[model samples]
Target: MPHAYQPPQRRSRLTRRGRLLLLFTALLGLGLGATVLLPLLSPGEAPEKPRQLLIPEGWRAAQVYAAIDKE
Candidate 1:
């Protein structure tokens, strides 16, 4: 059987602006994905819990050291 002659289809090409838009979209997606997944990839727990020390209103570091020195 003989095949009928057919015209070739025009290939679609991306313009420079379209290519830049695609690149921008891809980078934006990657950045958002990293932001979402970063917390899950971090360490499970902090090494130590934060502590708050209480000191009397008028006390100073020097006074604290002097008190410790007398011990």
Candidate 2:
């Protein structure tokens, strides 16, 4: 003997408005995630700006590097 087959039941799903709300939430999450992660992933070099520093005439390049590294 064989048993009769039955159709599968439909799943409860979000309505049209609920679908749109979910999409909006997903996009917001993606944008915020990118904003926080992008910086740490690629820290672009600091812009090179021309600035003058006044120092004793005798201060050599090595001394300047040492002084800056110490601070």
Worst lDDT run of 10 residues, candidate 1, spans 46-55
Q: Rate the local accuracy (lDDT) of all candidates.
A: 0.85, 0.88
Model 1, range 1-71, lDDT digits (tens) per residue? 59988899898999999999999999999999999899889877766876555556788889877766665
Per-residue lDDT tens digits for candidate 2, residues 13-69, read 999999999999999999999999999899699988886656678999999888777
Instruction: Find the candidate with the highest TM-score and give its number.
Output: 1
Regions of candidate 2 where Cα sits further than 4 Å from its true position:
1-9, 46-71
Please name the candidate that would achieve the greatest lDDT relative to the true structure: 2
Candidate 2 clashing pairs? Answer: none
User: lDDT, candidate 1, residue 19?
Assistant: 97
TM-score for model 2?
0.48
